[model samples]
Target chain A: MKRVKKWAAAITVFITGFIFLIPFYIMFYLSLSSPGDSIAEEWFPRALMVQNFREAWEKASMGRAMVNSLVITVGAVLLLVFCAACGGYGAARVKNKINRMIFYIMVLSMMVPGIINTVPLYIMMRRINGINTYWGMIMLLACQSLPFSVFLYESFIRTMNSSLEEAAIMDGCTRFEAFWRIVFPLLKPITATVVIMQGVGIWNNYAQSVFFLQNQNYHTIPLAISTFFRPMELIIICLPPGRQLVLRLLQWFF
Target chain B: MMAPAAVLFLVFFVLPLCQGVGISMTDWNGFSEEKNFVGFANFIRFFSDKRALHAIQVTVVFGLVSPFLLNVSGLFLALLVDSKRKSRVLLRMIIYLPSIISPLIMGYLWTLILSPRTGVLDQILQRFNPSLSFDWMGVPDKALWLIIMVNVWQFTGGPMMVYLAGLQSIPKDLYESAKIDGAGRMQAFKNITWPLLYPSAKINIFNNIIGSMAVFDIIMAITMGGPGYATESLSIYIYRQSFNGFAGYATAIALIMFLIIAVPIGITMRWMKNKEIEM
Candidate 1:
């Protein structure tokens, strides 16, 4: 009975895992197929050309795009963490009417769908000369990410012991200084979680990037990959699975 | 301490939202400063627009169905992993692989798979029975269904992770206690696990509601709301309308979309307030 149960569990996991990876399997299969090989015609690669990886890598400008994504992601995450952590801490500890109201408003703002803000945001970005600039994109991404991060930080901080922070404040440290020196350092775990979640989001941002970062030079990986989104175009898109894998791998490391 | 977030929320979020409401009431072409307030005219036009109404239908269907599917599947996977105990690390990673990349990329990747003759899925299905082969995204009837399934497939990892955390936090003693009292597996699960999983359920339900309802990039990448705009979500509708010189109409549509999402969210928040589900 025990043996039967073990085999059943293993097989179930195997099947689920295979289902999860079907897209990836298809991705790798097509990426290696020669240009002459038609995905419509071929079940597998007709000619295995490892050279396609290199060809697609250079063709897609993956390196420059990677750098753009990394810089933007790192900057945005740092800014979001700094601002949201403080906001969350304040919301959790201060408990004043203004702070409470602000917290509620921010939480409520999370439901305002992206499209609502896009038109005005685009106009504003152009007016402020923010289009195609790294800082502008970073600031925008950080703000798009702010409400959730603040909510997370607030809920998380509320669960922690406040007496230590209170003692720090009582010992002549200003509230800000106490939070910075004491509570901020201990936020490492939640900060890491925030960084991973928000970093993936910021790195993979497409909607705003397509609108805000339209310049060819400023395109991130996602924006770069969209070059092949044209109709009747699969081979050009599929061949660049190298960068997509890099995205998943980057996610894995985090 | 609240200064930075307060500033960001006010300037970026609150300000844009206020500007958005103002824009919804106007005739601005989204660029020219010249404008006129035409209150509720755009809103009236939405009921007349067949495509906009279709989008509301699609959005509500997608919104309602995806959360149910994701929550159920996530909990299922979480239980499977929790039962095994030793192999979860790798299993969790493998399951979560779909969610890491941008939905735009996911959409593009699906296009590669679901494309007509030259698509991977079509070729594979052709080999199997030939009759099984069909254009998945081309047909209007199947496209929205495909979008919802893809949405569920992509983000199931997030809910699964949450459920796994909730499952692990559950004390073994509860199960042991139930077993001691001669409860069957179903009874134990119903009486204990289901109630205990409320917090995780609430969070998952909330996230899935928002994520699936606001879905854009994937659908945009996959169908671009195409095959006669059959799969055009509210987000896509707003995008096309705004750029096509109906900026005021689009903002009005956006506000309607907000109300659609807000009602469910308000209900959930109230429910959360009342329950106060204890761990």
Candidate 2:
């Protein structure tokens, strides 16, 4: 009876895993087949034509959109990492009423639903001519995601040994130099986590991209793909690159 | 050091939130040279507006249903994968594969799968039931369910990981003692597993409820809250209102959503904190 139950459990798990994977397989199969050549219902195409990827890339102007996405993501991640690290270090090291208040406020206010800020932010972007600008969108996104990043950085930094930095300072290294030379390098693991999290957050972001990037030229990958209904484009962008990025990100948490 | 982070937070989040409150008091078109304040008019209009009320109704349902279902499934999957088996890691990764894709893309893919005519599902079903057709994206409730299903699908992975970790952290000695006490599997689980899993459950449930309540990208990509606002979540409603040149009304709706979401989350968190303290 026990053996039978274990087999049933294994089969159930296998079936669930298979079901979860079917959509990805279907997406991949669709991407490989030439458009208008066959029915999408087929489990597999008889002929595997790969030319659709290049055509889809050009037709959607995916290159420009990709470049725009890369710029925003890299810019936002860098700014977020640096600023969050600094703020986190201060919050961790400094013991003052004001600092404690700021830390608590940030952690609590992180629960504010993001959509509530959209209308006013839209207006602010327009008033400041931030619409369609990379820095404008990047800055807004960085700030939107800042509270959690600061929380994570502060908690992570607090657990690490601070004696090394104190020793460095005692040896006459300036504060900035001590942090840059001795302390920051130890933050590599948390830094990677931040990068993966923020990287995926920026790459897969559509709401802000749609709201701010009214011009087609400024569209991010997810935004561009959603606005334009091209299967090949969807697969090319969402399949390989997206899957790898997410897998890497999920690894950190696991 | 904190100046940059604080300045960004102030300029983007704090200031916009305050300004949103001010804007909600007016009847300003989203963009115009002239503006006049009409205090509480938009809020009053929200109470009487049928579409806004319908959106609230739908959002509440979506928020409640999706989070509940996601957590249940997440915990189930976590248990299934927690067995001491060789393929567990691969199985876990495969189950989580769908979550990594943007919900926008997932919604788009689901629309194709759920399409009535040329959709993969319908096409497969046609062979067995030639007269059968499913128009999930067109119907009101079905579209809502579809949106909810997609949300659950994309979000279950994170919670599953959380629960798996929670399960692992549970000391084996408790379970061993329960087994030695001649407890059945069900009895052992009831006594040992469920109570110990509360912390993970608390975190997962709270996150899921908040995240699913603000669901926008999936709804927008799939049906655009269309077929007469059938699947119009509050976030979508806000998006539409703002774009249709009713920034004040949109802000009013957003504020309502914020209060509804925030108050419950805050209360539940406090209650949970107390529960943790008691235990």
Candidate 3:
């Protein structure tokens, strides 16, 4: 009975793993196939050529898009992390009603759908001349991701002892300096989690990129990839610089 | 210190929400300077309009199904890979690989695989049974299920990781003590594991519910709410409306969706908090 159960578990895990990998395999195979050779026509490619990727990249102006995406993602992640860390620290350490209210409001904001904010945000962006600007996209994306990060940072920071910062403050360090030197460094683990989550969130974002970035010159990877629905473009869009970052994060988890 | 986040929240989040509430009552096409106030008209129309109503039904069905499916699968996978065996590490990576990529990419990939004539699945099916080509997204019901299944596939990894993290924090000594009492595996799981996992369960389930309801990228890429608005979620409908020059109407629909998600989630979170306290 025990032997049968062990085999059953192994087989189940193996089959499910295979099923999970099917789309990744198909996308990779289709990416490697030549353009004129229809992917659906044959299961395997006649020739494995990586030239299609280069063609797809040039056709989509992906170099510009990749740079734009990287800028936006990095900017958004930095702004989000800084503001969320401060707000989370305040809410976690401060015991006042206003702080608690702010924390709860931020938490409630998570339940608000992004679609609801689309029209008004567009109007506001146009009014403020924020359309097609990196700061415009970064601010909104940062705000969108802020609540979750604040929640994560708040919880993680709450678990940490307050004595370290107190001792630093007593040693002639200003409160800001104490927090900068002590509290912030201790938040490395949760900061990593925030970076990984928000990195992917900003990197792979589609609707905001398409909506906010009307100029083709300023298009992010998702926007450019969405414009052309080719298999080659799909492969290009799937592998961003953040892909390596996320893979590294998963490695750290083990 | 909180000023920046507070300012951002007011500008991007709170301000827009307030503006959306006001815009929903107007007859403002996106480009027009004239904003005619037509109070309650759009909301009433949302209830009466067939496409809007169908989108609501689709959204609700998706909300009901995908969360349950994704969480169950995630928990199962988490349990499977939680073992201390070396092979489990590879299994974790494979299971999570899809989720690490963009859902838009996954949706487009599936679109190619599920196309009636040119899809890989159809091509494979054609080899065995010549008359068995299937249009996975052509039919209304099937399209809904297909999007839901695809969403489940892409999103399960997130909750799986959450559960795995939760499981790791659980003290092994409890299980050891239970074993000393001659408690069986099933009993120990029921008495300890399930109860202790509630916190993770709450977070995972809540996240899944929100994600499934606000599902836009996958459906937009795969079906584009096609086959006559069959798989249109509220977000997709709102997207169509806004791009089609009904920005006011779209905002109105978006507000309704906001209420639909917010009220229930809030109540459930409160209820779960109470339950946690009781436990």
Candidate 4:
């Protein structure tokens, strides 16, 4: 009975793994197949065509698009980290009624639909010359990410003891300086979580970017890819170069 | 000092939110220079419009159903891959890889696979059984389920990870003790894992409810709310109405959606938080 059970477990794992991999297999197979390679007839990459990658890159202006996306993502992540880290510290240490209220408001806003902010935000962006600018996109994304980022940072900081920063304050450091010099370096773990979570969303942002960034020159990757209905371009972007996805995910697990 | 952060949040989020509330009260044509206030009229119009009501129904239905499916499947998959075997790592990654693709792209991917006559899926089905053919994606009911299925597919990674964390945090000693006591597998799972897993379930349920309710990009790419507005969600309706010269009315719909999302999430969260403490 135990042997049969072990066999059952192994088979279930194997079959489910294969079933789960089929969509991705289709992605690889379709993206690499030539025009003549029929998807219905063939289940694998028959043509092994690398030419589509070149075509997608050149035709889509992906180099420029990637740079645009990178700038927006990196910029937003930086601004969000700075603001959220400080805001989190302020929320944690201050323990004031107004601070708690602001923190709760931030948390609640996460449930508010992006649609609610779309029309007026566009009008506001237009007024401030923010409509097609990189800084403008960065500011908007960082703001969208701030609430959750601050919430994470605040919770992470609560688990920490504040004696180190308190000692810095006693040694003639201002509150801000104490936070900067003593406490900021210790926020690596939560900061990484913030970067991974918010960075992915910012890189893949579409709803607001569709409105605020209509100009082609300033287009990010998702915006650029949306113009063409090719899965080849998308799968290409989803796979980061030189890293297996298993490697990428295992870090989060182990 | 979160001064810069506060300034950005105020300028970007709070200001626009206030402006959005203001816009919902007016009869401003999207591009018109002149605007007139029409308080509560748009809100009243939403109730009278049948399309709006159907959208509300569609949104609420999708919101409620998809979350249940996602959490169940997520926890199940989490349990399946929660072994000590090395291949477990690979299985987990395969399940999660699709989620790395944006939902908009996933919609397009599914569309390319399932488009009516020319799609790969149709072609494959035709080859397998020449007489078997149907338009499931084109039908209203099937399309809603299809979108929910796709939503679950693309997003189950998040909940899976959460549940896996929860499962791991559960020490193996309890299971060993239960085994020694001759507890059946089902009984052990029911009495131990299920109760201990509530926190993860709570998080997954809460996130999925709001996320599925506010779903937009996938449905936009999939059906574009077609077949006579059968699948048009509240979010999609807000977008369409906004651009089609009913900016104020659109904002009103969006605010309604906010209430729809906020009130339930708030109540459920409180209820779950209390239950979690009790557990």
TM-score of 2: 0.92
Every candidate's DockQ is 0.59, 0.47, 0.45, 0.41
In model 2, residue pairs whose N, Cα or C atoms come closer than 3 Å (at least 3 residues apart or on different chains), thus clashing, are none
- B103-221: candidate 4 lDDT, tens digit per residue: 77677667656766655678788889977665668898889888888888878888998999999988889999999999999999998998899899888888888888988878876
* Arranged by lDDT, best first: 3, 1, 4, 2
Across B186-213, the per-residue lDDT of candidate 2 in tens digits comes to 9988877887888998988787878878
Ranking by TM-score: 1, 3, 4, 2
Model 4 docking category = acceptable
Residue B189's lDDT in candidate 2? 83
lDDT of each: 0.82, 0.80, 0.82, 0.81
Candidate 2 residue-wise lDDT, A125-189, digit = tens: 89999999999999988987888889988999899889999999999998778877887788898
Best by DockQ, which number? Answer: 1
Angstrom error at residue B105, model 4: 1.4
Q: When only chain A is evaluated, what TM-score does every model earn?
A: 0.86, 0.85, 0.86, 0.87
Tell how far residue B126 is off in model 1, in angstroms. Answer: 1.7
User: What is the per-residue lDDT of model 1 for residues A1-254, given as tens digits with 9 covering 90 to 100?
Assistant: 99999899889888888888888776776657665665556667777767765655676686778788888899999999999999999999999999999999888888776667887788777888999999989989999999999999999999999999889888999999999999999999989989989888888888788778989899888877676344334444554443343333332333
Compute each candidate's TM-score over C-alphas.
0.93, 0.92, 0.92, 0.92
After TM-score superposition, what is the CA distance of residue B22 in candidate 1 from its true location, in Å?
1.2
Task: Give interface RMSD, per candidate.
Answer: 2.7, 4.3, 4.7, 4.5
Q: List pairs with backbone clashes in candidate 1.
A: A40-B118
